[model samples]
Target: MAEHNLGDSHQVFDGEGKTFTINDKHVAIFNINGDLFAFEDACKHMGGSLGKGKLEGNLVACPNHGWQYDVTNGKCVTENECESGCRVDTFPVKTENNEIILSLPE
Candidate 1:
């Protein structure tokens, strides 16, 4: 696994999300309450940018197709069988010295 220092925690406000490209990998980072969650930026159904999606509690709905995913675990919660098996990759995230840290698979 590899770790990256994304940036200041303030970059993501409570109940908001942001996108960061590291090593040519697009990552979506969300801040819910005071905790951080990271996942692949692209949605599985149509490659919509999850980073720019709408956040409702811990779920983010893709703006393109309305596919929602649980930000806490990357599970598809779109309420349909067509997307029952769809899921995005999630990464470990934390904060240190006020900087957001993210871990990706090596």
Candidate 2:
């Protein structure tokens, strides 16, 4: 278990950008404009790392099976074979001193 600090939330744009030390458990953090959001980086359909996927608007499309998820809400849009309750765990992000702090429970 480890803690990492990502700089100001406003530095990222709407694409496959990464935050410092924000990669773990196949999860990754991304910023849309100045809003921060985190998602299970692995795609539910094929275990694809979404951090390397393409970001279309607020949605991140899985590179493996083309499964798309709404980065803002983690909503699957590919209509894959995942169970209705299947969903990625969303992280709670806070900003302080112009920096984005992600709190993960160990």
Q: Model 2 misses residue 48 by how many Å?
A: 0.8
TM-score of each: 0.95, 0.76
lDDT of 2 by residue, 1-106 (tens): 3444677666666565463444445456777776778866778887777777788788887778777788887878776466676667777776788786776668
RMSD of model 1 against the true structure? 1.1
Candidate 2 residue-wise lDDT at 52 = 77
Q: What lDDT does each candidate get?
A: 0.92, 0.71
- After superposition, the stretches of candidate 2 with alpha carbons farther than 4 Å from their true spots are 1-4, 8-11, 19-24
RMSD of 2: 2.9
Clashes of each: 0, 0
What lDDT, from 0 to 1, does candidate 2 have? 0.71
